[model samples]
Every structure is written in C-alpha cells, then in structure tokens.
Target: MSMNPITFTPIGVIHSPHKSKEGTPIQPSRLQRSSGEVEIFSEFRPGLRDLEGFSKIFLIFHLHAMQESQLEVTPYLDDQTRGVFATRAPSRPNPIGLSLVDLFSIDNGILKVGGLDILDGTPLLDIKPFIPDIDHAEGIKVGWLEDKTHHFRNHQADDRF
Candidate 1:
C-alpha cells in the first residue's frame, strides 16, 4: 500500500457564536439548540438549491483549531485513556469534524442552522442532508460512551486536547 497527501478546497465557512474551543460544545446539542449560519462560497451556491427542503443536515468541517494529534486520549466525558478512534477528540490524524444541525432556512448562500457545535470561521468541507430513514440506526452500542452520555448536556470543550 502507498500513502498520498490529499488536498481539499473549503466550500464555505461556518459562522457561530463559538469563537474559542475552550467553551464550545463538544457536539451538537438538541437541548442547547444554539443557532448559527453556514456561508457557502459564491462558487458553491448552486449546491444549496434543494438543501432548504432538508430539516436537518450534516456539516463536515476541518478542525482547524487542533494543535496536535494523539493516538490515545482521555475523552472529554471520561477519565480513562482510550484509543483516539474510539472517541470524537478534535485532535486526530485528519482533524475533521462533523455536526448534525437543524436547517431552518437558506437565503442566497447563507444557511441558518441550529444545534451548531462548531467553532466560528471553521472551514466547511461538505454538507449532506440528514435523511432519518438512511441515517438512523437501531441496536447500536456506544462503547465507553454508553454510560458517559448522561453527562453530555453538561460537557463543554476544555483545554485537554
């Protein structure tokens, strides 16, 4: 096998109230219901044509604030050190992040979204409609997070990573 560097041009920018990772939510929270805007670049505005119909969307963006990567990390919700792949730590080999947000409206190239957990000025990679029939699952296990998720609502970004 061979490895090659891959490059991507950001499609847009994510504008949110989260200016720093220190206080940003680790993930999108339906309870918090924070609202923000996704500004798609002019060249990508055509892709937003049918996006308004989606009630929710998945925002794929670069974790630009990450300082480094760790193979093992103490996840925000737990004290045990675990493999990075087992947790959603921002400092990863690729530093990519995903958020499922409620889509309220789209005007021109700006998208109004709720439940945003991403930091402001984050580079948007892609956006996909969240089709419940396709994205929802059953009989799933969350590993270490199974017991830690109850504290999700109270968890916020810290300087651990």
Candidate 2:
C-alpha cells in the first residue's frame, strides 16, 4: 500500500469572534447567536451563484493550529478515552473539521454566517450547501453519542487535541 500526497489552496478565510479555542463552543448548535463571515476569493465568487437559497452550508476546513494526530482520545464532555474516529476531536489523522453553519446572507463574495464552532482564521477547503432532503437521514443510530447528547450544548474543547 502507498500513501498519496495531495495539496490544496484555501479559497478564503473565516472571520469569527472566536480568537482562541478556550471558550469557543464545541459545536455549531451551541453557538446559535455567534456570527461569522466567509470571504470567498474573487475567483471563486462566481461559484456561489444561487447559494443564498439554502439556509445552511457545510464548511470543510483544516485544523491549521493542531500539532499532531492521535488514535485514541478523551473527548470534550466525556472522561473516557475512545477511538479518535468515534469522537469529533480536532486532532485526527486528516485534521479536517466540518461545520454546518447558518447562512444569514451573502453580499458579493462575503457570506454572513452564524453558529460557527471553528477557530478564527481557519483555512477553508470547501463549502457545500446543506440540503435537508438529501443530507438528513431517518432512524439513524448514534452509537456512543447517545449518552452524551445532553452535554453537547455546554461542551468546550479540552486539551485532548
């Protein structure tokens, strides 16, 4: 087996009030009132045509500041160590973070968004509109997440990353 190397250029930057990770919400749902902006590069501005119709968009980004990856971790809101894939902790092998944020509006290439849990100045890889009919699944199982549902809103990332 071989590992293939790939490269990417950030389309733009994410502007959020969250300058640090210490007090930022661990999930978008917990930060409904917080607002942010996505500044898509001028070259990619044309790609956003008709995107305003969607209420939310998925942001795929790199955990730029994360130093390393781990296979097992004690995630935020839980004391037990679990396989890294089972948790949303940022320090994964890929170090990619996905956030489904609310789209308030779009003017030119700047998108007004809210409910962002990502760090300020994170490198964005791509943005995809969230369509409920296609993205939502019924009768799904959450595995270990079932017991941690109640703590999601209050959770904050610890040093586990």
Candidate 3:
C-alpha cells in the first residue's frame, strides 16, 4: 500500500464570535441564533454567482485550532470514550469541520450566515449550496448519537479536544 500527502488551499476565512474552543457551540444545529461571516478571497469571488438562490449553504472548513489528533475521545454529549470517527471531535487525522448554515445575504465577497458553530479565523475549504432535495433523507440511523441527540441542544464545547 502507498499513501501520498495531499494539500488544499483555503478559499476564504470564517469569521465567527467563537474566538476560543471553550464555550463554542459544538454544532450548527445547537447554535441557530448565532451569526457569522465567510469572506471569500478575491480569486474565488466569481464562484459566488447564483449562490444567493439557496436559503442555506454547507461550509467545509479546517479545524485550525486543533492541537493534536486522537483515535478515541470523550465527546461532549457522552461520558464514554468513542472512536474519533463516531464523534464529531475536532482532533482528527484531517481535522476538517462541516456545518450547514443559513445564508442570510451575500455582499461583495462576504457571505453573512447564521447558525455558525465554527471558530473565528478558521480556514474555509469549500462551500456548497444546501439543497434539501438532495441533502436531506428520511429514516436514517445516528448510531451512538441516536440516544444522545436529545441532550445536544444545550451542549456547548469545552477545551477537551
């Protein structure tokens, strides 16, 4: 087997109220009222055309603040340690984060979004329009998260990761 290193250039920066890992909302669904900005670089501004038609967008970003990677971690909603992939833990081999946020408006190269759970200064990797017809599904299983979803609404991030 062989592996190759992969690199990606950030398309923009995510500006959010969360300056620190502690107390930040763990997921976008948990922070619906929060607002933030995604400032796309000038080179990528042309890609923003027709994006306004969507009510929501998916933001894929790098977890820039992650200090280390862990194979297992105690997630915010659970007391038991779980595999990194089973939980939405920041400290992972790739450290990528994704969130679906409300697209409030787009002015110039800046996109005003709501329900932002990402941290400030996080590097934006990509943005995709959220299409409910394609993105949403019915009768899905959440695995370990199924029992924990009920308590997630009030959960905020701590500095564990």
How many steric overlaps are in each model, in order?
0, 0, 0
lDDT (Cα, tens digit) per residue for candidate 2, span 33-100: 66889999999889899999999999999889888898998888777898999988888988899999
Error of 1 at 27 (Å): 0.8
- For TM-score, candidate 1 versus 2, the one ahead is 1
Residue-by-residue lDDT tens digits, candidate 3, 40-117: 999999999999999889999999999899999998888899999998888999999989889989999999998888
Top candidate (TM-score): 1
Model 1: residues >4 Å from true position, as ranges?
none
Write down the lDDT of every candidate, Cα atoms only. Answer: 0.90, 0.86, 0.90
Give the 10-residue window scoring lowest on summed lDDT in candidate 1.
Answer: 147-156
TM-score of 1: 0.96
lDDT assessment of candidate 3: 0.90
TM per prediction = 0.96, 0.94, 0.95
Candidate number that wins on lDDT, 1 or 3: 1
Q: Best lDDT goes to which candidate?
A: 1
* Backbone clashes in model 1: 0
- Write down the lDDT that model 1 would get: 0.90
Off by over 4 Å in 2: 30-32
Each prediction's RMSD to truth? 1.0, 1.3, 1.3
